[model samples]
Target: MSARLARARRLGALLLLAGTVQATPVHASADQPEFTVTGAPADRRDVITWGASADRMSNAVADRGYRLVVHTSVAGRDLRVRLSNAFGDRPVTFDSVYAGIQKAGAELVHGSNRPLTFDGARSVTVPAGGAVLTDPLPGRIPAATDLVVSIHSPDAAGPATGHWMAMQTSYATQGDHTAEEGADQWTEVLGSWFYLDAVTVRPLAGTGAVVALGDSITDGWQSSSDLNRRWPDYLARRLHAADADVQGVANEGISGNKILADGGGQSALKRLQRDVLSQSGVRTVFFFEGVNDIKAHTGVTAQDLIAGYRQVVERVHAAGKCVVGATVGPYKGWSEWDAAGEQVRQEVNAFIRDSGEFDAVTDLDHILRSPYDPERMLPALDSGDHLHPNDKGMQAMADAVDLNSLDCDSRSRTG
Candidate 1:
């Protein structure tokens, strides 16, 4: 089975393992750090280098430390990480947090590990459903480096919030060893991203970011794990080497997420503000979703899905940001696919290509579908299930995107 398909199934029972500790999200006391978000300035250059969307974690833990390794998309300085508790029923208090450059398994590059502060405080407490963006650390973070974030919470218990199906390797421990730069103490390998969701950096004044908003494909299910082969990762590399103003990339794809309703995660319509709009220095939204809704045989018409896409475009426009829509690719062999679903997919693709409602469009369906059978994915690009793409397909999708369209008229409302 492809990792893409397994990831979707993993979501159903994630809580079984993480189903441990924590109470409702809580506000910080005078001495306790609070969850506070000071959005990046409009005139400056703060861009997201790495991102993992938040989802409900049925499990919680106390006195546990996490060593999360994420690949940076854009090179910049003043690194910051946003810790999330967006799904916790109880408050979470992170007693220690550190960031560094990874050397070997669980080991940090010498002299790179540094402590992080939330508004000058060493510790922070996120409310039942809130997040805290850390004060920027002074230093330049190189693009494409394996950035590791170490975290420890003394009293995390209850339903927690985090990202499942990370498609990357992270580490965890039973105690607060966040300050250590060695690997001995961090032995447990974890697949999910806990607490932290977004990382940002300040690059050249004019440089910005493009957020790839979608499902498993964008999340990089079939792509090589721990190697950052997602379509967005490829896009980031392209942006970096090119002479474009948009250099940042955030993958906000959830495994089973849909555009119209909640299931895999919050519906795209629901998460746009928090995931897409809130990211620092985002210039365009690369919208690619709706396959889940279409395949489920829920009686969702192409018109219904189109309406959902329109809603997203309108909301993003209202925020003054540009949106680039991508045509949904073929998924003829997946279990739920039927004649009715194929028709819906065709109509949706037609609208994506012909409709000018989006600021711009990328014909992903055209690029990924088999010419001989438009309803089926090309064998070479298909990840076997016919719904998700392989590494080559991901690269094709990223390469298909026009670099100029990402800026959306010289970045109208982008941060």
Candidate 2:
């Protein structure tokens, strides 16, 4: 057998033979010793490189370490991570946290793993329904890098808070193995991120980010996993190539999430502060939700959804952030298709397109609908479910967004 294949097989075997591994402590470097900072300037804010909306966690496991792989959107220095226990009924303690560069599967780039400190402490306890951010690790983090955040949770319970559809493959292991940089101990594969929700980095002056708030489509349900083909991912690529102030992108999409009600996760209204406004260096909110509410047949009328949209717009404006609204795309072939839902969708889309409430609007309905059948999705764009879009469709959606609209200034808001 080839040496590489042989090594992979051996690794696979070790992964299946799960056992407790002693945690390795990450020592602070002599030159770059970990320190704490209080009341940092808001202008030196950290922009979110990777974020997943927290929801009730499933498959909770105690005394486990997670090595999550996330892609950064903007390049900058001073990296940090945010851990959430938003849905947990009890406090979750994360004893060890490390940030590093991924070299390969479950492996770290040599000398890249750095210990993360929270308020100058190595350990932190996140209370139920709360979250905390780590002190920035002093260094430069380039854009589009495969950043690995290793976290060891000693006492995790209740519904472990995490985003259900990560679309990325992370690693996990029993016990506290967070400090290890090698792939040998990180044997178990984890499809979901636990405790860790967001990673942020301080970027260039005037650089800001836009948070994409939506449901399954924005959550990247049909996009290929581990490839980062979500629409927001594509939009980030565009922002990097273009001359725009909004270069950072945070996807706060939750599958089955709604703008009006709470079901799949906290409603967009409830999560707005935690997911959008609370993030550092967020300048704009890209609102693209409401299809679930319209199709759920839950007696949600057009006015009800419109009122919800108004609330979102007003709240976002109150935070002094631009709001980019996207009309709901067509979804006719799905089982929930009905004339009443279609009518409500039309009314809502009309309001989204004609209303002057939003700072900017992207007609996703016009972009995704079939030319022949307005109520159905474009077959070429659909991912066969006639609901979610494929990678190409995701790109199309990203392309539909106006880069200039994302960077609106205060004068533009009033104008």
Candidate 3:
């Protein structure tokens, strides 16, 4: 055979072999193990918990609608629904909770939703400071389903705890937007409510979770709920859009969570395992906590706060996972307003901006703080509380973090 002909035949043979390999699915990929927990597989225990003062009340609208949108890739069979009232003073009574496939930026239809049951019947009550796992009989989630969970309150809940992350401003199908509407029960109509607790769709085995840990700012206080304005939520949206290789975010920012001692619900140190390290598929953590520690207590200097930060970093690192530190933003005339505290905050901020201990640094403080008044927060950014940034401000903070920087994938041991 001619030399050219022989080489051509060899190349063709190699191409054929590559095609066969690509066509054949590996057994390991086909039969990967699904996540199994202490609860029943048929039951949906999707609500992840954190927070303080379940008793603290905020007036939400009556008969309002709340919806949770999640984009999931399901490789497992037999899917179900899960809901949460993880932080409640009294029993969190669900007037109605339903789940079903949904369209992008739309309300769930009544006929499409399946009624969820706890134990074996309609309506389950989750006690204060505890959660209930519900049966999956209500819904059958298809593979890679975008599940929408719509729920409403049976009674008034003061201070309806929420981590709002609506990308565009979420609208109330009816009525003016106010804190009072948050207390109102959500009807079965196609209206959007605020706050998304948890959404678990089957993930391909080995899909890692990116846990965004922070304070009320991270908790998304004023970001119009349903609009998906919260930075973390925006990050999730961005990740989904980019078709990134990681699972979506598991946001554990309680309105008042601090890094030092217990404040908002449980301090960052206290809730690390439950919120970040303990999460299934969690391989990376983005830490934006510690403002509360500075704002809540005056005795601790910025140096003290930095020490607390080091401790947090040490704990996170010891777990063999990656930790990204976000600098504390400018807060003026807010809680614990003191020149000394501000000075301390600046010192701590400098450390965060320059810290080499962290696997990555997200300069959120520099992104949102006022340029004219370096100490004072930007008017547009500050929520009326001054300490917490408004929705737009939160978006800027989220924008500041370079998602590309969190390239390391390190899983931590579950304690």
Q: How far is candidate 2 from the true structure (C-alpha RMSD, Å)?
A: 12.6
Error of 3 at 215 (Å): 1.7
lDDT of each: 0.81, 0.81, 0.54
Worst 10 residues of 2 by lDDT: 17-26
How well is each residue in 137-162 modelled by candidate 3, as lDDT tens digits?
A: 43344433456656565563645544
Candidate 1: Cα lDDT at 372: 99
- Candidate 1, residues 152-197: lDDT per residue as tens digits? 9999999877889899999999999999999999999989999888
RMSD, one per candidate, in order: 10.2, 12.6, 11.6
Model 1 stretches astray by more than 4 angstroms: 1-44, 410-415
Show how many residue pairs clash in every candidate, following the order shown.
20, 0, 35
Estimate TM-scores for all models: 0.89, 0.88, 0.64
- Model 3 has an lDDT value of 0.54
lDDT of 2 by residue, 243-290 (tens): 466788999999999988888788898888777766777778899999
Order candidates by lDDT, high to low: 1, 2, 3
